[model samples]
Target: MTTERAYRYRFYPTPEQATLLARTFGCVRFVWNAVLRYRTDAFYQRQEKIGYHDASAFLTQLKKQSDTAFLTEVSSVPLQQCLRHQQTAFKHFFAKRARYPHFKSKKHRQSATFASSAFSYRNGQITLAKCREPLNIRWSRDLPSAPSTVTVSKDRAGRYFISCLCKVDTEALPITPKMVGIDLGLKDLFVTSEGQRVNNPRHTARYARKLARAQRQLSRKQKGSNNRAKARLKVAKCHAKIADTRRDHLHQLTRQIVNDNQVIAAESLQVKHLVKNRHLSKAISDVGWGELVRQLEYKAAWAGRQFIQIDRWYPSSKRCHGCGFVQEALPLDVRVWDCPSCGTQGIDRDLNAARNILHAGTALLAGAESCSKYRGALGN
Candidate 1:
């Protein structure tokens, strides 16, 4: 089967290359903000939405203006891609999939995309338009095919990376009969129906003190000063470290789960709402439940496994797996519960929920057409 994948690598640019890339990043950000502002004003004034083509056409007029003539210094590919991205952002906003587009900030990470036409890869080196030397990319692994698109980004910590998106032929793994359900929680990363518990690494909590110290030092520095800039990078590095650790943990866990199970079931958690609780918000965010679910979904799909998400309000925690008895009100503190209807006692809530999820997913797969509306089946 053909699978699309992104390969990312850290690249060290020469001083001259860095200067050029920085300029490119600035131009990309500027174009994004400019197009977004124009789109917003046009929509409000004329009640009309313009797309990428319209934005691209507007760029010609923008370049004719004295103030924006310098925009031609960088390769036009990245700027055009920026406009395409803004168009997509607005499309998503109009479709209710995301919030309204916002202006890009120079303080944050900056990225630009180079389509196949804008870059060439030859002899283990990548050369982009308007650049003399090829990019010094550390090829950690070999690519199976020429990338369709390449994106270059520089983070707040001053690290540069290139991500290439390519499609490759992959052999699907043999289907497994073992099916399992997963219940996610802050205490434990996840509990499987098969009585397995994966501990939450709590990356953010582990580095909380270090991050706080860095932030405090940052706050003490004067704004726009060199010291403040250094402090900001330190803070960014701390946040990046925590995120990297969490992502690595989730990827490992999801890979193992997907490889072992043919059908993987999980709860459809409304994490945005769940994180609203002031008491548990920190823990909830630290566990990265949403990221875990997202990883599980894509990994399972790639591995030819079934990934199913039951309804968010399916009462996975309240229902008894043994007796199918559901308590009207099960408080968050009640980790161990006894099913009064069937006299089943000492049931671990998370484990029971996992098993219930497994059962529901199996039932839905077996009877998709006749499945009840209450237990919605979301699978890929």
Candidate 2:
């Protein structure tokens, strides 16, 4: 049986080590933005001079620009990879899978990494290519396949992370009879088809007062002063804490669901599009739909469960689970409703939706190819 896998672990790095990692990340951003600018300029020139333009010819040459001292700071392989990504993006755009190209910004949280870069972990010492200073690490397990490289990253809040690209052959999860469907909402985190409720915990919003006070202190401090930097760090730490708590809660909940079930069905949410509606956007963001689906994806695969994704337009909410009658209009505010046909009253919206999601999910599981077609229809 085929099984999915990943590389997971934490790292221990000193302050100096972190700075070095940050510099490498900067180098990657510099290369990408530099080429991005070059490509845009070339395309504009071509459009003006001739009738049409091509990105490949210019991007190909851009990759090797560092050869004659044009871009000395860039690693050869990484720069080539960046150009390859541009080419790939264009391919996807032409295929109608993605949007047209856009510019990269320094202000945005970003990083570029080369998969060919050396990363060796022997005992507690981890060595990076061309960098003599080795980082300290305590790996939780003996890796099955050696990691070819590592990606060092820093988020907007200035927290550091390194994703080790090691390989492992996870055993296929044993099968069972249990299957479940879940509905996602803001007021309530999740409601399973079996009546299991996971309450929504708004970690970030819970600390809104503390965050406001920190901003007030930050505003009062003189710009470029040591005190200002310290205050900024405090805010970053607070944001990080909330994110950590939310992740911990998600991990624990998903683990329970995956371990106990052999089949899992969920909605295919268009999270990016859903966030555009400003009226309920904050509530949607607080619900954390994207993160929840992401965790479910890998966890389901790890458990060897049949993971089914029904259509976003599946009308999971407006349809009655007891009968097949569809309610044409169910407002967001009406949390509790009764099925007129079956006389089932006091039906909780989230729970009823979960049942519908499961019904759709179960239909998909019986025919694996149909589920694949369903995902393909969504351009997955």
Candidate 3:
């Protein structure tokens, strides 16, 4: 099978290259902010929406201006890519897929994209545009194919990475007969239809005290001082570490689940609405239901496995898998319950939910002619 994947690697830049890259990042940020301001103003004043072409056409004039002449120091490719990104952001906003484009901040993550024309790879080294020396990259793995584009980014922790996007050939996994359903929760990341439970890593909670201490240290330092900067970096590193741990665990879990099951079913959770409960919000976010479902979805597609999401309002937890009897009031505190109709004793709520989900998903798949219809049904 053919696939498009991004390979990311850490790279160390020489002082000169670092300066140039920093300049490029600044220029990209500047262009994005400038165009956003322009677009916002035009939309409000003239009821006109600006687009990529208009932005690109105006870039030359922008660089020629006295105040913004510093933009000339960086390669024009990153500036153009910045405009393209802003344009894409606006498109997503209009489509209601994302929020409106906002001004880029220097304090946060900064990135610049390089198109095929902007970089060249030779003799196991890659040279970026306007740089004399190739970046010293720590290649963790070999690329399947030559990358068409690369994105360079610097995180708040002062770590630099380059992500290369390329098309690659993939060998499809062998089809399996087994199927399973998953119920996500705070206590356990998920409980499978096979009575298997993957405990939630609780990455944020694991390091919460350390993060709190680091944040406290950051707050104690006076703003604009070197100590404050160091403290901020510490906080960033802590956050990065937590995020990395969470992501690594999720990837491993998802990979194993997808590989084992030919058909994977899960609840279509309304996480945004669920997280409104302030008491449970932290725990809910820490579990990352959305991230898990997302991984299962894309990985399932890649593996040619069926991924079904039962409707959120399907009453999976309340319904007894044995007798298909629905309880009128099943409270969250009721972890174990006996089904009145089926006389099923001591059934775990999460396990029952998983089984019910699998039953519903299989039934829907057998009855429905189109998967798109089921997807639309869940969306509603």
Model-by-model lDDT, in order? 0.88, 0.71, 0.89
lDDT digits (tens) for residues 213-237 of candidate 3: 9999999999899999999999999
Candidate 1 lDDT by residue in tens digits, 1-380: 89899999999999998999999999898888888888889999999888788899888888889999989999999998888788788889989999998898999999999999899988778898888999998999988789989999999889999999989887667988999999988888889999999887778878989999999999999998999999999999999898888888888888988888899999888999989999999999889989989998888778788998987768888888876777899998999989898899899999999998898888878766432543444320
Ranking by TM-score: 1, 3, 2
Off by over 4 Å in 3: 369-380
lDDT of 1 at 58: 87
Give the higher-lDDT candidate: 1 or 2. Answer: 1
TM-score of each: 0.96, 0.82, 0.95
The regions of model 2 sitting more than 4 angstroms off are 1-19, 47-77, 85-87, 99-117, 138-142, 220-228, 367-380
Number of residue pairs clashing in candidate 2, backbone atoms closer than 3 angstroms, sequence gap of 3 or more or interchain: 0
Candidate 1 CA-lDDT value: 0.88
Kindly give the stretch of ten consecutive residues in candidate 3 with the minimal lDDT sum: 371-380
lDDT leader? 3
Top-TM-score candidate index: 1
